[model samples]
Target: MYDRPYPGNLYIHEILNGHDVRAYNYFRMPAQVFTGLRDLLADRGVLRDTRFM
Candidate 1:
């Protein structure tokens, strides 16, 4: 998300941190892949039996 430093950076810096700061962006890349896997698990009804549901 460093490459997408438009609204994302602004939002994190201005709203989240209240100033310029370095922080991890949990919105793209590996996060997206993990979210996709979670969605897939939900679609397969696997998470229905787990606390993740």
Candidate 2:
């Protein structure tokens, strides 16, 4: 996926570039909240796998 974040607060197709990065996609827990955390850490590649949450 492209590294470009959505220009505004609203995140639609243009932000994720076709990937279903919505909160509902995650398996366990509130999709929206966890997805936000995941996006901040995982999708952005900010934290390494070995790093503790």
Candidate 3:
């Protein structure tokens, strides 16, 4: 995945040239929310390994 900065937000993409992307209002996002999502993804095998940065 990769991130790109915009005027007042950021976008994260799961693929470089595909449609799997999401826009983040980063300044308003809570860290726990991200962690929870990561954990869910790992549990469901959506992520290859249970690893996150």
Compute the lDDT of residue 17 as modeled in candidate 1.
Answer: 43
Model 2 pairs whose backbones collide:
23-31
For each candidate in turn, the TM-score is 0.36, 0.26, 0.39
lDDT against the true structure, each candidate = 0.48, 0.49, 0.44
User: For candidate 1, lDDT tens digit of each residue in 1-53?
Assistant: 35655654354434334322222243334444555776899899886543322
User: Which tens-of-lDDT digit does each residue in 1-53 have in candidate 3?
Assistant: 23344321223322222332232343244455565787799899896642332
- Minimum summed lDDT over a 10-residue window in model 2 is located at 7-16
Model 2, 1-53: lDDT tens digits are 33556433234333334344543353344545555786789867885554223
Candidate scoring better on TM-score of 2 and 3: 3
C-alpha lDDT of residue 32 in model 1: 41
Candidate achieving the largest TM-score: 3
**What is the full ranking by lDDT, best candidate first?**
2, 1, 3
Report the candidate with higher TM-score, 1 versus 2: 1
Q: Model 3 — which ten-residue stretch has the worst lDDT?
A: 8-17
Superposed Cα deviation of residue 3, candidate 2 (Å)? 36
Better of 1 and 3 by lDDT: 1
Q: Is candidate 1 or candidate 3 better by TM-score?
A: 3
